[model samples]
Target chain A: MTGDGVLAQALRYLNDPLSWTAPGGILDLTGQHLVMSVLAALLAAAVALPLGAWLGHAGRGAAVVVALSNTSRALPTLAVILLLATAGLFGDTATVLAAALFAVPVLLVGAYEGVRGADPAARDAARGLGMPGGRVLWQVELPLAVPLLAAGVRTAVVQVVATVPLAALAGGGGLGHVIAFGMGTQRYGQVLAGGLLVAALCLVVDGLLALAQRFAVPRPLRARAAATAAR
Target chain B: MPGNPWFSLEWVRANADVLATRSWQHLLLTLEAVAIAAAVAVPLALLVGRRRRAAGAVVGTASVLYTVPSLALFAVLAPLLGIGRTPVLVGLVVYALLVILRQTLAGLQSVDPAALDAARGLGYGPAQVTLRVQLPAALPAVVSGLRLATVTTVALVTVGVVVGYGGLGQLMFEGFRNNFHRAEITTATLACLLMALVLDTLLWAAGRAATPWLRGRADGGRRAGHGQPARASVRAGTGTDLGADGRGEAA
Candidate 1:
C-alpha cells in the first residue's frame, strides 16, 4: 500500500464514529483498559505499600525485599498472563493479575526506599517529640515518602496500561481486540489506530502522574527543589 | 497420571528437545536485542553526558519509547518487518533503550567534578580526561544499567510469542493454544523463570568481578555512617543502589 493510503486508512479508522460507539468499540475498549489497569494498580499498591513500608521501617528483611523486587521485575508478564488464563482464571482476572504482578516490584521498591531513605534526623526528632512509633510513621515518614510513592505509582500505572493489551491475546477484551482483529484480517489501519491509542493513553496518564508527583512533594521539599532549580 | 495432559511427567520428558531449542532461541533473541540496544544507548548517552543540555530530550524520548506496549509494537512492526525474529528483535531493542540509556547517562554524569578538574590540572586534554577518568569511573554504573537491561530484555523477549518469534514464550503459547496442557504450560513457565534467574545471576557475577573495588571501598566507608557507603561509588553497600539508579539520596 502507498504511504498516503496507509495514513488515510488509519485516520479513517480512528475518525469513524462506529469505532467509538459499541459494546466492543474503541470507547468501550478504552474504558475496559482503564478499569483493568486501575484495578490492577490498586491491588498491587494494596499489597506492596504496607509490606514494603513496614519492612523499610523495621529495617528487616532486606534480602527478602531485594529478592522479591528482582523476581517481580524478571517475570515475563505475557507468559504469566497466558499461563494464568490457561489455568482457568478466565478473562480479565488473568490480565489484572499479570498487570498487578508487573506493577508490584516498582511500587514495592519505591515504598521501601522512600521510607528507608527518609532523613534520620527528622525521624529522630519525631521520636524525641514524644510521638508514638505509629504516629511518627504516619505523620512524619509517609508525608516525606509521598513523592517516591507517586513516582512508583506513576510508573506502575503506565506499565499496566501498556500491558493490558496483552489480555486480548488470551481472548480477554480491551483495546487490544482492535489490534488483534486487524492482525487477523490484515487491516493495518485498525492495528495502527489501536496501537496509537494505547500509547496515547500511557502518555496522558504519565503526564497526570507527573503532576501528582509534583503536588505530592512536601512543601519544604518543593521549595528546596525550586531553590535548587533556580540556582 | 499419564491421562492428565496438563501436568504429566511424561509430557515434560517428551518435550525436552522442544525446551532446549526454544531456550536457545530465547537466549539468542535476548542477547542480540541487548547488544543492539547497548550499542545505540551508550553512544547517545555519551553524547548527552558531554552536552548535559541534551540529557532531558534523550531521556524523554527513551521514556516514550519504553511506554509503547510491547504487544502493540510487535503488531505494528510485523507488517513492516514481517512476522518473525526481526519485528520481535526491533521491539525488544526499543524496550531496552530506556533503562540502559538512563543508567549510562546517570553514570557518566555522576563522575566527580574534582576528578575532572584534577585531570585537567594534570595536563589531560578533554578527550584524555573523558577516556582516562570519566569512562573508568562510570564503568560500574554502566554495568549496573546493563544488568537491569539484560534482565528486562529476557522477560520481554517472551512476549514476541504473539508474533510467532518468542523463544520459550512460543512453547508456552503452544501449551495454551493446544488446550491448556498443564505439564507443557507449567514446564515452560518454570523454564522461562529459570532462564531469567540464570541470566540475571550471570550478569550479577560479571558486575561483581568487573567492580572488585566496590568491596574494598565498602570496608573503607563503613565508619562514615549509614548513607556514606552508598555514596562511595564502588562499594558492596552500593551494589543494589547502583542496580536501580545513581541517586543515593532518592534510592
Candidate 2:
C-alpha cells in the first residue's frame, strides 16, 4: 500500500533513524521537554508544597487556597510564556518559569486539600499521644497526605510535560520545535510526528506517576481509598 | 529615547479594530467549543450515570484525550482538518469534554437517592425523574463544570494562534514576533485573563440564579440548625472541590 497519508507519512518520519539521533532531533527535543517539565515541577513543588501543607496543617487559609486554585484556571499558559519572554527572559528560562506558574496552583491545592482532608481522628490521636506539632505534621499528617500529594505532583508533571511544547512558539527548544518548524514549512508529516511524540511522552509520564501514586500510599490507606471509591 | 511602555495607550488606539475583532473571536470560539462540549457531554454523562464500569471507561478515555497537550492536539488535527478554526474548535471541545463529563456524572450521582425513590413512588417515569429531579439537583456540579470549562477554553483559545484561529492568542503571538512588543503582548495577555475572569463570574452568578434553593439557604437560613449550616457550606465549596476533581482527572 502507498504511504502518502498523514499518519503514514508521520510514521515514516518516526521510522527514520536520523529523526532520533540528529542534532535537535526527536531524542534531543524529548530530553529538553523532560528537563523543562521536571525542573518546573520541582520548582513549583518546592514553593507550593511547604506553604500549602503548612496552611493546611494550621487549618487556615482555606479561602485563599480555594481562590488561588480558581484564579489559576484562568491564567493562559501561552500568554504566560509570551509575557515572560517579553519581560526579557528567553529560551528555556521563560518556558520553565511560565510552566512553573501554571503548575503551582494544582500542587498547592493538592497539598492543602491532602493535608486538611487527613483523618481528624488520626490527627487528634497523634496529638493526644503527646506528639509535638512538628512531629505530628511529619509522622502522622505527612504520611496520610501522601496519596493526594502524589496525585497533585502527577497532575502538575503531566500538565508541565504537555505544556512544554508551547515553548516552541516562543523560540524555545522542545518536541514542540519539530511541530513548529513543520507548521512554518508546511510539512504536515513532521508536525504529526512531533505531536505523536509529545502525546506519547505525556501518557508515559502520567502512567508512571499513577503507579507511583498508588505505591506511595500506605497499604491500609490504599484499601480505604478503594473502599470509599467503591461505595 | 526611552523604550515603549508595557501598556501604551497609543498602541491600543492604533490597533483598536484588530484588538476588538480578536477579542470577539476569542469569546465566540470559547462559547462555540463549550456549547458543543456541553451538549455532547451531558447526554453521554446521563447515559453512563450510575454505571460504574461504563463511567470508568468513558471518563478514562476522556482523561487520556485531556492529557494530550493543547498545542499537540492542534498540530495533530491540523493535518486532518487542514489548519483553521475547525482544528482549534475540535481541540477545545476535546479538552472541555473530560471536565464537563466528569462533573456531569458527579452531579448526577450526587442526586439524593431518596429523591429518586420518591419520584419513582410518585409514578414518575425514568425520563421524568431524570428531567425533573435529577437534572435540577445536579445543576450545581454541572454548572461548576461549565465554569471551569469556559475559563479553560478562554485560555486554550489563545493557543489556537498555532492554527491561525487563536483569537487573542494571535495578538499575543504577534506581539512576541514583532520584536517582543511589550505593549501588544501585555495587552493581549491581560485581555485573556480579564475575559476568563468575567466569564467565570458570570457563570457563577448564573449557577446561583439557577439554584434558588441554594441562595435561599445561604441568605435566609442563617439560624437553620447545624445540619443546614453544614450542607450550605458544602454547597458553597462545591465549585472548588469539583475544580480540583476535574484537574486531578484531567492530568
Which candidate has the top score in lDDT? 2
Off by over 4 Å in 2: A1-4, A227-231, B219-251
Question: Compared with the real two-chain complex, what DockQ does model 1 have?
Answer: 0.46
Instruction: State how far residue B27 of model 2 sits from its true place (Å).
Output: 0.9
Q: Which run of 10 residues does model 2 chain B get worst, by summed lDDT?
A: B221-230
Model 2, B10-95: lDDT tens digits are 99999999999999999999999999999999989888886889988887787788888888889888888887899999999998
Runs in model 1 deviating more than 4 A are: A1-5, A223-231, B1-7, B219-251
Candidate 1 lDDT by residue in tens digits, B1-251: 34535467777778789889998998899888898988998878776788756887776677667767788788777666666899899988887777777777777766889999999999998889878888777766667667777777888887787677888888877877777666676777777778777876776677667666665754432212112222334434533331221111122
Residue-by-residue lDDT tens digits, candidate 1, A92-157: 899999889877777777777667767889999999999998888788888877756666677777
The clash tally of candidate 2 reads 2
Q: Rate the local accuracy (lDDT) of all candidates.
A: 0.73, 0.80
The pairs that clash in candidate 2 are: B160-B166, B161-B166
CAPRI accuracy category, model 1? acceptable
